[model samples]
Target: MENEWKIDASESDVLIKSRRSLIDYMSGSKNNFKGHIAIQNNEVENASIEFSLKVNDKDSNSDLKLIDFFENDETPVIQFKSTSFQKVNKSINFLKGNLTIQNITKVVELDAEFIGYRDYNGTKNASFEIIGNINPKDFGLYYNSYSSHNGYAVGSDIKLIANLEFKNQ
Candidate 1:
């Protein structure tokens, strides 16, 4: 039997990291996201997630500039819908999904780890860590020419790490 689980937003987090140089990077996190997963026999059957594309970086100026790169006013949300899940082991799985950003959708493969289940306050909860990399240019996010000159060019790839907790529903 497949069981449905709703994400516990308060206990989940999505982190974003973008490198501007070899040693310089900006990181931010988001806790406001909605998602659900269907699991059968301890394996994920399907999953989908959606969240606004806001990066709460520590530096206000950097945050604003990053948001502009994403054209947030025009396309404000990022969405993912799983198409397949391939179990690699008891704990690791490869989740292939369609990721939509800036009105462009691309197929991406994410590394998902099943962190097991816990009974918290009489409710069954599951935890997972999903990680992936994406190129901003692929989503039509181009780096500013001024910022690219010298040694300030932002890296092409952005790293995404999601720590998700879901409650049985």
Candidate 2:
């Protein structure tokens, strides 16, 4: 599998699967949430990967938004933020006199670090699984009835699925 057109990922290519609840919020709404660099070219090592992964708002569609949080100061310690759909959603009740709560779709970004680098293989592609939250309120979604409940609007969870081909060049 290491012939080189595409490389398969080994156990080491997984990097680390981290759950970052906090990001800029504007930059986490993307499908290609992460990036990778081939550490080997023609079986020789030569590349570094810099990437960021966007958590799922669950929709897996065009109705996604992101917020970005960048580092502004230099410190030996690292700090990150965490948030959920509740931050952007509106609650709706059918009691005749209630605030209109709309659902918000919020895409969160996760942090991943490459654990190690290795050679390439057609069967050795890197795969990632990210977890995050989405709020319909941020996107302004509402339910027609609160009593009926529609049965589907129970939770705000998102997921991301990807098939990556690693090429060492």
Q: Against the true structure, whose TM-score is highest?
A: 1
TM-score of each: 0.69, 0.29
Candidate 1 residue 8 Cα shift, in angstroms, is 1.6
Instruction: Tell me how many residue pairs clash in candidate 2.
Output: 36
The worst-scoring run of ten residues by lDDT in candidate 1 lies at 22-31
**For model 1, what is the C-alpha lDDT against the true structure?**
0.69
TM-score of 2: 0.29
Pick out the ten consecutive residues of candidate 2 with the lowest summed lDDT. 92-101
Candidate 1 residue 97 C-alpha distance from true site, Å? 1.5
Identify the candidate with maximal lDDT: 1
Tens-place lDDT digits, model 2, residues 1-169: 3333232232221111113221112122232222333333323222222223433233333222221111231211111222311111111101111111122123344432223333455334433222223343444432222244332222332222222345343
Model 2 spans > 4 angstroms off: 1-34, 37-107, 111-121, 143-150, 156-165
